[model samples]
Target: MNERIEDKVHFTQYISVPSPTSSGRSAAWLAKNWHLLNHLVELEATTLSVSARIEESIRGRMLNVVVHLCNVEDDTDFTELVLLSLSSELVKIQSISADYIEREVRCNLRGRRVTSDENDEILKEIMDALEKRGVRIDYS
Candidate 1:
């Protein structure tokens, strides 16, 4: 009997969070004048742009997002925005963890551990969407 050696490679994916052209502008406006628009700003507006990475494995990918927020009193609004944006990514979420780092908040959203077969199909779709949205991604 012969054992097959695992062909392993570490894929480090990088995504940049720029102020979204159309949506960013709207969000910014709301953030600045949230006090005026009583019903406009749903959340407290703690965050704006988010930077994340996808570490791919034989099973599934892990997503780590660094959430950035404007200096405000609370983060309820910002967190909602972050989650909404991420939900559009179509990454099967497994777990979510968050913490504060000085002025920025780091929210690590890990994807459901999947097998290589599932990954091969969903990986490109998610990557393409991110790329199309101007979220620069680099895999190595």
Candidate 2:
């Protein structure tokens, strides 16, 4: 597989999760809605984290997230995007604020790179899928 760290695409988007939760609740919400994290791409290890912010006031809509995307690369190259995180990548995402989000979105581009428009489209699809799951996270 192509494992070039420099080749991966990395981007961050501030999003708002409508659940509006407090400490413990965020993780609980994430755990409960585990199936919704990556509705577009079902990757367990890649999407299992919700940072618990303990402060004077328990607020919602403050989710510091990291989302990594990967594509299906087979001989046929079907029309499917599978969410996957290698163990190494998992370690990095966990140590950071955005748990499980790394700069590792696998793709077979023959030689070039993923354009901005393409990236936007993919993100929109992901956000849309998440919205359908009752979790509205803006990708602005």
Q: Would you list the C-alpha lDDT of every candidate in the order shown?
A: 0.35, 0.35
Per residue, candidate 1 scores C-alpha lDDT tens digits across 3-113 of 222212332322223355669766876577556444322222222332333333334343333233222444353431122233324344322221221112212223422
State in Å the error of residue 135, model 1.
0.9
- Looking at model 2, residue 124 earns an lDDT score of 46
Off by over 4 Å in 2: 1-77, 84-112, 138-140
List the candidate 1 regions with Cα displacement exceeding 4 Å.
Answer: 1-113
Q: Global CA lDDT of candidate 2, please?
A: 0.35
Candidate 2 per-residue lDDT over residues 11-38, each given as its tens digit: 2323334345575776776687566455
Worst 10 residues of 2 by lDDT: 47-56
